[model samples]
Target: MFVVPKPLRLLAALLIVGTTSANEPIKLYMPDAPPLTLHHYVGGHGMVGDVVLTALARIGKLTHIVAEPWPRAQIRVAKGKDMLIIPLSRTPERENIYTWIAPIMELERAFFSLDEPVTSFAQARQRYRRVGVGMGTAQVGILQREGFSNEQIVQLKLGENPAHLLSLGRIDAWFTGIPEALYIWEASAYREQNLRQSPSLASTGLYLACSRDCDAQLVEQLRNAINQLEHEGVSLLLRQAYLPLQPDP
Candidate 1:
């Protein structure tokens, strides 16, 4: 009996099935971090969001993006098949957790202090009793790596204001990206709040991360699209809209 190999049979089946499954919209998730992801205030999303949308549109096909609070969005993207979260900080702790795409942007990881002055991460680690940060953010891991104990890290729930926490003397400082912090402060009364920018922890590149189970071919395609966008300055142009002007809060 002549036996057909399993791989050949699968190829034949796919060829017969065609590209209907491939046409399904790719689902994307993002947090409410401004400049990177402006959750629900304007233009559907912010700079990075606009960049991704433009790239995907130019690439064609997949066309859906969703914004959720970090905690819920992170969990969804990390486990959901083929789902992705954008402007994700590509950290050592997260390096292997998901499949990474091109760097959407570089963000300065910073510590913001209120009432008292903390100059650097070392000073903040040694002097501050508690540091507040949005949950499911790279800042949380960065702070943990700075030797902050679990109790020393204050996780701000979605929709809760870290600046408010700092102003109320709840947390000693806040750890987040420079643009994100500034965006929040500029759009809210927090600009004049006691919070002040402290020393930067590090400059980190943020990317779009797909679940591990995602198709590798699609990942590569998306990466190429973003690379083209960045190379051609479309991404930079999209980013320019948010500069100086307070992005839709």
Candidate 2:
């Protein structure tokens, strides 16, 4: 019987593991949330998507991204096997639903209005009659926790422009991530002078997450790749490139 040397055995084992990881199919589900992710964006993926794609490339993994409504995407990714979701907020409500790989960005939630900004959630509840929030977003839970009623929370469908709704007096305010609000404002025909952003309501890390029963090796590979990108300042540069500069709220 021929025995392989220990060093040779180790090298072979590593190569086999690497080959398997590289061949594994990774499907990343995302919504059309601008700045963070937009299917039709110049890169065919926005900031978070860019960061995720870069990480996948570094790990020598091939992935297909599916664009779906936020609610549908979340459900699909959470239920699918070994799949991934991008730019997902790692909220307490969603903490255990998925296997969180790594945070790609920090998202600050805020209230945007055409009038004076409310100083606090308490103030917002008192002053605003109806607040617009994206359907299936963490913002909905945030507002509910802040004592907002179902009537006060208007769940807007995908492609519903909060700014447009605010301008038309449909919703008294829009509660959303700052980067997304700023990106929408820049792209819309709305005037910056008219839009008012409240002080940050909450801050959370947006992550690249896999399905609950994700492959351990795949998670490790992607996590290391993401950490490397963050260390190299690639994440920061991607954010800067996508998010527009605006005055402090």
Instruction: Name the best candidate (by TM-score).
Output: 2
Error in Å for residue 247 of model 1? 16
lDDT of 1 by residue, 1-249 (tens): 111111212222222211223476777787667767765553436777776665565555355667677777777787778887788888898787788878988888777766555677788878888888888888888888877889888888778987677777888777878777777777776666545666666888888789877888778877987887788766776676676432221
Q: List RMSD in Å for every model shown.
A: 10.5, 8.7
Badly placed stretches (over 4 Å) of model 2 are 1-24, 247-249
Error of 2 at 123 (Å): 0.1
Query: Could you tell me every candidate's TM-score relative to the true structure?
Result: 0.82, 0.88
Global local distance difference test of model 2: 0.80
Against the unseen true structure, what C-alpha lDDT does each candidate score? 0.70, 0.80
lDDT of 2 by residue, 1-249 (tens): 111111212222232222224464578888888888867644436778777876776676666777788888898889888998988999999998999999998899999998889889999999999999999998999999889999999999998888789888999999999888888887787765578889997988999999998899989988998888788776676667677768455
